[model samples]
Target: MSQTPGDPRHALPIRLNVDDSDSPADVVDALFLGRFANGEQPYSHSTSIERVKPGATLLPPAAEVVRAARDSDRSATLAQGEGWTLLVSRWSRGADVTVTAVSDELAEKVLREAVDGAQDEPEPQPENVTMGFWYVSPRRGPHRTTRQIAAGTWAEVRPNYTAPVAEAMDRLMKTTPDDIAGRLLLLHGPPGTGKTSALRTLARSWRDWCQVDCVLDPERLFNDVGYLMDIAIGEDEGTAKGRWRLLLLEDCDELIRGEARHTAGQALSRLLNLTDGLLGQGRNVLVGVTTNEDLERLHPAVVRPGRCLARIEVGRLTHRESVEWLGTEEGVSREGATLAELFALRRGSGPASVPAQHDGADAGLYL
Candidate 1:
């Protein structure tokens, strides 16, 4: 065992006998705990986890402090300084870097230095929105991935919506952080009405002030408490500390329908808690849901006054608007046409000639 000379209390040597059979995680744990075991040293300790930015590598400032380190394909590098031990574990998309130091200030300082130049920079295209996606993996449990998706401006796609829907969306598109009165944004209507398109535009419009994330397994999210908490408390990297986030759960007709209490069990309650109950108290998180169910079919608790920021029914365009959109009324119906139908018409395939519709249960496929 070799010990660095210092105040005897803080100079405890990290000496562990290793065997070939010892796992990498076991060794890493020993190294971290050996350096700063509780009550062994007179210094206070703190730890923090940082989600590394995409395309950024852990650099010199962090690497230079290392005394004893280890590396592997899935790596965990442990570094020691005067009174601190830092552990950085790299994963596929990001690294979880944690620092334990003598004081909260020192721990924070070390963490900041380690992650300072490691965040992804904002792209030049404002229409390209960065989105986080949450899902459960069979092997890894709950996980999140991020990507930059192109979402055109609301103005460019305004013609896809009916006049009334467009008017409502205009107000939503112009919303700033100060205008937030509720934490739920509900979009409900028939299929092929451009609900998904409107959400993409909303993401682009609110890119500056908000982060948007899609829960790929929304059904599992509400059912699993641990997964739900992970998402609720997970901070978005590359954004300001207090930035708002919109969690989009698409095609959640059953989760918010009138019989959700009976069908979804505690899922509905958990969803409501995330938006307005104790779980939502100090978090700047908003829940955005898209459903094909009509407004009357949704749960009253979900659409209650003061519970939602916006509840817009994104329906088909009116007959007049549909005629104008297609440049002729050739395939336009007297009632109206969905955005999907209009696109089909423009592509020389009228709605009537389109393939047979699937059972109504899977209407979100048109999105």
Candidate 2:
């Protein structure tokens, strides 16, 4: 089957198996983990088949297991699970290459008609779901805009009650869209204090109201924050105020090197300037930088009042917080550490050790 050409959504590897009877040519389409490059879809068209169940979109890359059973009859195979708009190359016989859109069943219905017409009696199995899988057909263009991991995807931390972070996010959202233009919003704190977690939730919840979302991965900062700003410039502003492209800059402390005002330091300063200066005035950019740094030591320019318009510290959970976590059925209890430490420990897989007391302070993770 000739796949319609399009840019790859994820450069990450995806393995699809085609048995001997099945022509490698029909071996098109790929299933990726979650939204590749964070849902920045590159191609368009056609749903895919599944690995385990007869039908379901493969949401995680880890589930990219299993293979196709090649029957001898030469009938078109069912569309595999959902497509992640990946790029794949192989040889095959069938050729249906047009990026068309259809409902879950209607889509499979059309494919069923196209491939099985006059070939075999169609089985009406209700188990299969037919839905558009963004990219079975491809497109010609630059690769999908790569993801800048400024913010991570939001996970449901709690149900029913909006998490505490929502209070802070409420403030962020209530801001007049105009107020968000070129402003820096910092969420900083000790590790496991939920700074990053909170930001993830904020961005995801606000996605509908915002134009575009871009995360600034720490890995990308091979250099200056200036490079980060350049990303904001290039991203499309699908809606006004240049779609809300929130740059999630983590690891703020790592940026400060050399004496303050040195070349690198100035570069760092420029990063802050880019957000707060004329460049930021109407760009419609809201930078949410999370760091474990002491704000006072940060360059006055970067740490100034309006530079990072709002500075909120996600501190240690209180004693009551500890009880809440420990008393919970699913969460780890505060047996080995404080509520904060226990939370981190549970999230980790490696074995943990409790160090001996210091200054007669037996209180460490044990506390």
Candidate 3:
């Protein structure tokens, strides 16, 4: 299926797998029945289906259509006529629609019905700021595969960093698009030191002008051209101020290290290429990488001066800071605590809450 230029939603053609014995219409009906078992009213008409997609309407390219289907916050409406079916699915990223029939005439008629039925439907409004993790879809190839995961906000993620590191972050957060020359932000720290938390704050602060999307699979992000292209070019926003996109890669220790040249091969090269090289040239995109590796061990090209807008080393909070964060009257004598430990401390007193530290270590996953 193709979308007209003036249309706010982009239509993606979804190929349905029909059994040899079952007709395509029957396969469509089966999808609705499955949803019904799950208490979803997927069907809306006498014999039609209408469901909600995630996210607002932002028509993405063909490569991003399927991702949009699974990620957008829009609705999916199915209207069928004899020998034809027209399906429209909206996603946080965009929309994915399917139109199928034995003949073009029937398909056209179904499409018109689907459109007319949706005329009075209110346009879905997505959250002003969204933070989510995306993974390559197993059903679709990397190019069109995207699944979104909800992420925390700055208020929810209370990151406690060293004064210097916190100051650097504050400066970066205050920097606007015109204040920077480079497009890369590298946050490196030990495990459980709130690197991901800092990234979340950045996303929340930049939400007005930036769209933050996490790449769940950093190993294949740059290695796969189709995936990289879909993320870099296919997902740019259509809004006047929401043109910028931040691609977050978490715990990518191997991709930026000195040995990455040989170990990660093209992955390292492609990452640098997107940082400041010609590949990143016209796109208003920024790359943020969180690694546990030291800067000294990273490729010189990756950490070279002027290559990054902000290079922050986020470490555990100081003794005093941790004491304040933990809300103790007197300062603790221990070295410090990671944000994870602090959060666990806050939760430990609650019902069914687990201890913050287990065996002298943070008791939760890092990022």
RMSD of each: 6.5, 14.3, 10.7
**Model 3 regions lying over 4 Å from their true place:** 1-84, 87-95, 100-128, 143-159, 236-242, 329-333, 348-366
What C-alpha lDDT does candidate 1 achieve relative to the native structure?
0.78
Candidates 2 and 3 compared by TM-score, better number? 3
lDDT of 1 by residue, 128-216 (tens): 88888889976357877778877888879999889889999999999999999989999999878889888888988998889899999
The deviation in Å at residue 64 for candidate 2 is 32
**lDDT tens string, model 2, 132-207?**
1111122221111222223333334322112354455556645655565337777665554556456545655565
Hey, what RMSD does candidate 1 come out at? 6.5
- TM-score to native of every candidate shown: 0.70, 0.46, 0.66
Clashing pairs in 1: none
Count the clashes in each prediction. Answer: 0, 20, 16
- lDDT (CA) for every model shown? 0.78, 0.43, 0.61
* Candidate 3 TM-score versus the reference: 0.66
Q: Best candidate, TM-score-wise?
A: 1
lDDT of 3: 0.61
